[model samples]
Target: MLSGERLSAIRAKVNRAQCSQNKKSATLSSVSINGDRITERKKESFKTANSFIIRGKIEENETLTKRGERSLNCAQQRYVVVVNGKAHTVFTHRCRSRHCQNCQRIKAFVWQEKMKEIIPELSINFKNGKYLFITFTVKNPKITNLRLVLKCMSRAYAKMFQRKAFRFVVGGIRSTEITRGKSGDDEAHPHFHAIICLKTTYFKKENYLSADEWGRHWGECLEAEFKKEGLEYNAADYPKGFPRVDIRVAKSADGKQEITNKNIAEHGDQLINYVLKYSIKGSDLLKDGKADKWFWEFDKQVKGIRMIAPVGVVKKMLADLERDQFDYYKEQEKIEKLIADDVNFKADKAVFKKEDDFDYYMESKKDRFQYIIEAIEAKAYNYQCYYKALLSDHLLAFRSGIDGIIENFKKIKNTKTREGFEILEKAEMGLVKIQCERIERLQFICDALVRVGLYKKMSDFEYVNIHTKDKTTIAKNNIVGVMKAVEEKLLNDFNQDFMRLENAKSQDVFNTVVDRVNEKSALIKLVRNEILAAGAYAYDADNCEYIDLETNERLEVIATIE
Candidate 1:
């Protein structure tokens, strides 16, 4: 009912709006999730550390680039979840590097949660146990000797704990922290923070270790260990002929009360977090945005070394708990595997083992289209149909299997269980393989159709929008681009097999040629489908597009037949 000019103006507005929407969708789809993109303040935590490591001069290590890349890409891909009508980005992949700030935060949180459970259990088990917060330190060592100093310190700690004077104390937790000492940039001050569990009887005159005695015992142990490590320990360098050791009653966050078993769970959070914090503080590492000599040395010194550990009773209890959790997961995996294997067995029997008349029909037919179709239908069935079904069945079982594992993981995420995140990762990997395999199969069909002149090979449509973020170019976005990339990867081998298949005339030779194609198809499947369904670009073959695995949709793409 509107005038022509008004209608034209309105249509123009709608077209502009749609173009804007498409652009926004393309940008959002470049990341892990799509749909009204949730924006949040991302912490640039890895920037400083990653720059430091990659820039710092180190011995020729093969893993340096891989390490840098992992850290650089950590948490870049995130899954979007909606809660209460609000969208938020959830946790994704992490490098788990020693100095990664994000990983450190997660590690500290897990430890804090663990201590909440452990402290209360230990307190109840050892009714008369008294908790003591202890700090064991040594005179600053040259930066070059930091690794040796840490090794000696660990040995000394172990030796001191095993001494007869320490018999009254049960097990505890120990964590190492290193700092650039005030002495100079070339010196390192490494120390241990421990929450020691002691029997109430330690307060008695006979079993108690005086402040001076504790220092002396620690000094003796350190001297012995330093000597064993072939390093000279000069008592003259330290005040009072020994390094200083600080001892105090473990207190709640509010300093009003000492933490006992009854209050440990509630009060132990602060102490636990402090003890389980990162080995080197971020402020120390990224101070002045410079990677100094001390920082570089510290990174090398602590490589592959464990900075935190449980001792004595704490060690035993945790080990038992882990073992129990492991057994539970193993039992669950066994049951799931049995069920999955049975299902896969039945599927394989029904599909591959059962004979069909399709091959006979192909043997009798003279048409190349029918032969190619029959070859495709048979080879494709054997190529991945069972594998896909098996993986799909396994993926479902893995999700069901990980319920208990996920709960346990919540309590302590670093705990590795075969049936936990590992299985989930495997299932996800299988899914990516299936996606790639599905695309490969479709490409194979389309190529065969093109050979027979039923479908046309086309080019001219870009599968993804040209976009950039932070100066890094993202890979292709949609399924069509992914399929083309996959095709290119397998192009050489595919060329050889495809040419041979095209020359075949006899049915026996045809089956043999198709076998080669099947062999190449089964060789490998891609796993880069993280942003698979991000774009609306579907592969174009004769103006027909296959959008989803189940639905074949017709899309008129801007393309020219080749």
Candidate 2:
């Protein structure tokens, strides 16, 4: 069956087919190798960034500790989230620190989503109106004066709006942003970004303010505030007495007369994202091999500052929308809890490699052990550097010890007074201090939540009169008992003073009794008002329940109004 020429041709064809298959296999192998390298590089980059963040946090914590201030620590206490494959997906944590890059990214995403929902409403409401993006800036200030500069900037913006010409502004959003200055300038540059809603009348030639006029008005306001604050002003430093102020009319994609809903949404999204960017860049904190002075000072200055605020109609609408959303989320959570037993959902466990294990795993086989040892040394060295830096601050060291001593003294006083007549007086004083601190901390948390539009403000809560029904339980009964105890204490103090006044032993005794009654009444009333204001409810004798005015679920009442 084999002809010589035909057999040779067939052999050639077979050889060609084999060669082609081999080539494809080689190509695939190469591609697989390249992909592995890319993934490795990505993992390395993530680890490096994570390490930097951890180091920065440690340094910040050290500084704060030295100054006897509250700082974000507890690196291990992170909210871990796993996504995708067991080995394929990179594990991460929700650090939730203000200066964390990962947390900031998540925050930005949340902000974008919220803005996306709200922007369409804004477009519909102000269909006939025009939009403008205005940026108000001030000269970069030294780290020491950053807080004051920020205060001045805020006051100036408020003052500018108070002017007769700015009466046309209906609704707008304001965000305070700070960035590190580069080259030949002080580091902290504070500015304001405002998404201004303008009436149609503002588009007219007569009413329109050019960029130059905006700069001038901004400068005047800034300068006046600066003078009032007694801050040094140099005409040469800022020839215009203010940093650059930019104003641009927002336009549609096609540059047409009528702006579309899509255009408004996109524009609003961009402005909000820009405004909501991290107050301080993480990179600025730990640059190169050392932490910058600016980072430490900036952290101290920005404590308790409200970085974002909405004004006018936008504020009211946003508040109402947020409240509704919060309620919806709460209801959804309740439903999920109810159905949790029936739902067969499997959650993927996040696998976080320990720092040492990660380092060892990432190393090449040839020098793995050596690399691990070096990595350990490097980490130890970094900690030493942080410790050294903290020690260098003499003032912080002195201040830190003072707080410790005071705390120890308080503890000692408590133990020593256990067997003495003065025990009640000391205990009462300590209780007062503890109560004050608790109130302050609560207020701080509430303020932060309100600032971020996560929770309703006190005034808004009062307006809504939102209340939660209480259930019958031992815990609930105990809460009721505490409330009664508090009430009884107040009544007993009042009754004792009244008896003393009735006796009228002497003029001095009568006056003292009267003063004591007035003081006790004022204190009791103040405490009751504060509890009610914070959304705690009084016990209802008829219902045999203590309803909660703050939250939807039944919770133990720590305090209540009369």
Candidate 3:
């Protein structure tokens, strides 16, 4: 019953969809899961840094106590769940949804499933409910140089079973790791979490090495590997510390940390889920409930990334995680998925297909791309090239890794100056009308200040702190300009406060050498490198064997009154 025109339109749509399949993104893969790409920028917001930092402590799941293990399994047996506040109870063995499930054993079940998929070679035997949970961590280096790191790690993982390399007796070794191509905050930095299996025989020779020791060894091994690649680093000089490797272990009975990271490489059943998590479009930035508890609006509206941790929220997560235990991991996973869902909505909100320039282009793709894929189930095309020049341009415009720019902008709050500072402040927010006009006016003033002869010594632009879109440049400019203004003001103040150079004259002093003590102007002794100024009180001078200021306390570069 369809009209010929409508049918033609449908066919064209199908052709475009088919052509999309052959297309490739410069920084992305073609795979998609749950509407989330394998590794894409998370599109969402956040107002604080606590969400990820303090919660880092919960990275390791706990081991259950001997007595607790029995109860944990018993609790996992068939149970009833009442949806919401409803009266009727649904017959169920256990709830895996981290929040509503009683005993919430799904975390364990999920782990089991994932292990089989990712590390099929792992030989795990939980006898008497004793399963050792191990975790691995590593510091991320300059993101641009990831090839060496990944290559080294791959080698190390493969050599785990070799006693000569690791110096431990272990057999049946397997490695399963989950790598996040970028961070949840939307910074495209790579990091990996790997889980491995080792023979139980090594525990007998050097048993009780402490779980921390294991983590340290793992970190050290990675360090050695990085050093080989010349990618190792020292964090003592960085303003904010980077991530480090951790080797924490827990017994299967003890898995309690309220923070559930779905990307962890513990088990394999969640392979698709884990893979989707690494994708840029799979973040949970949009949600009305607890998941949307934090983040700034602009971050959400823009690329849907850049959520930092708030001080208060970090404290709460820490307090809650301290009480986190193995008995509740399953419940946390559900909450995590919901969070993931929220982030995904924001990531995929807009899709543009260009590569070189951050702009959309309309170019014929009949030659470059072989086919284009539309959604999941669209028709195919063969004559079209697999890659279209138009798609290449789209990829280039989608900016996700330029975090250095954002970091620099964060420093605007420190600039000082009225015209210059205010202008920068207005620019930081990209606000409307009045503020925008003020910024423009300031720019004019900045240009004029340079041209004015009176302030010639001061550069046209100087460092200043003002909250603006580009705070870094404003701060740098304001500093020089502010200093120039201060110097001129000081000169003017000095001219008004005292006699002029015309009144200069010399005075003669009589050599009245007095031998008495109290009358000799306190008889202070001379000091080496002693600071003396118009208002400085020099009580603790050098050669002062007995001075009031020369106490037993150690001297400091700058002194504070006690």
Candidate 4:
């Protein structure tokens, strides 16, 4: 209805306003939505990572169940202690399952602390020493042959170090690690990282071996030892093969870093920590969605193997330090004590009490200690009763089995003559093997019983010496004497009947043994339930609950009253 120029001008103004409004809306949306999206992504990624971790644990548990081994059920259960209002300390009841991430982290932390102390001592002792970081490797082994390959590699490593070339090596720390190969390469890679110290003279231009030369030497030694051990080796995978060797000169300082004793010690700590950080990577086992099959195989293979070995003077030094520390800790009742005089005082501003005041504090809190000890004693008593009954039953079977073996040996001994001495010797050797194996089994069982808190201490059980005249006679008599002594001791200590049916003509012996065992089992269950119940209320009177530093969320205290 208006003129063209006027209408055009109004439309243009409206368009400009609309554009400005759109820009404002876009700015606001981006500021809010973009930040929210980033946060959501981060949370989602964390959740996904945790899912992978849990999946790995679930797989490990399944494997354990299949193999009849115990799985870690209480891996996340922690005992948290809050010091006044300032500090929070977290403690875990470590399950020590081979693949537990939390347990591994704790072990790594402890190892690092120990290494820190040991490194400075090394630097002082070996003032003119040169260090070398060496890695020894072999071809990636299939899951089925992982154990054999590891054994072969270990023996080879020992042989290599014993070679004349290694005589100049003064001390070293060796740690073994295993990792799963990348996606397409589906094999377990097992290798060793060693920090070896050498005399200063070994680094002389004429004496020094180049990195490549060192690699060649490693290969030759590994191959020769593997061949000697009757292990199969691929000729093609040698000299320039999959089993690569790495050798580097370790320095006390790098780049422009000034050389000082502290720096040198720190350098040594870094080298040691790098190798010992993980014996096996938990993340490698749970790559993608499922657990790697090879990792499980590797775990099973190295069950009882020692992954770290400190050799030469380092070994002795570590052993001495460890012994001293152990003795110190064992004698000290309270390793850590509260800093403040009052429970409600804040730790940040509180002054720590002197050692003289420790006894007074402990005396004041004697009730808590007494409560924990009583609970432990009650549980231990029940455990002892249960084990006594269980072991008594086992002893009966062992006695009958050993008796049969002795009877066989007796026949062989009685029938032996100087003319048939060779036959007698063979029979005696066979019997000795059987006896030693049986005794070892018994020792293992007894040790387990002690470890499980069923027994306070392990009793020494002497074995018969088979390398003597009248060996068979001595062995039989010793076996009989040992069994009789064990039976008597069990009865005396446990205050329970052994139920020697051979001596009892009563037909009720079986029923009597059954009743006793049932009674012990019931008592064990009752005590276990009581212990669990008491544990809930066993908080330290001095220590409060731990609070998460970041979230400021308070964690429930699971203090050890003892």
lDDT of 4 by residue, 267-302 (tens): 565666786776776556555634555545565677
* Model 1 steric clash pairs: none
Off by over 4 Å in 3: 1-135, 156-190, 232-244, 250-562
Model 1 lDDT, full chain set:
0.56
Better of 3 and 4 by TM-score: 4
Q: Alpha-carbon error at 127 in model 3, in Å? A: 7.8
Worst 10 residues of 4 by lDDT: 345-354
Candidate 2 weakest ten by summed lDDT: 80-89
User: In terms of TM-score, which candidate is strongest?
Assistant: 1
> Candidate 1's residue-wise lDDT over 406-490, tens digit each?
2332333333776676766565444444544544444443343333322334432212111221121111324444443443444
TM-score of 4: 0.48
Per-residue lDDT over 44-72 for candidate 3, one digit per residue giving the tens place of the 0 to 100 score: 11111123222333443232122223322
Clashing pairs in 2: none
Give the CA lDDT, 0 to 100, for residue 530 in model 3: 18
Each prediction's TM-score versus the true structure: 0.50, 0.48, 0.25, 0.48
Error of 4 at 128 (Å): 1.8
Model 2, residue 189: what's the lDDT? 72
Q: For residue 433, what is the lDDT in candidate 4? A: 55
- Which scores better on lDDT, 1 or 3? 1
Worst 10 residues of 3 by lDDT: 375-384
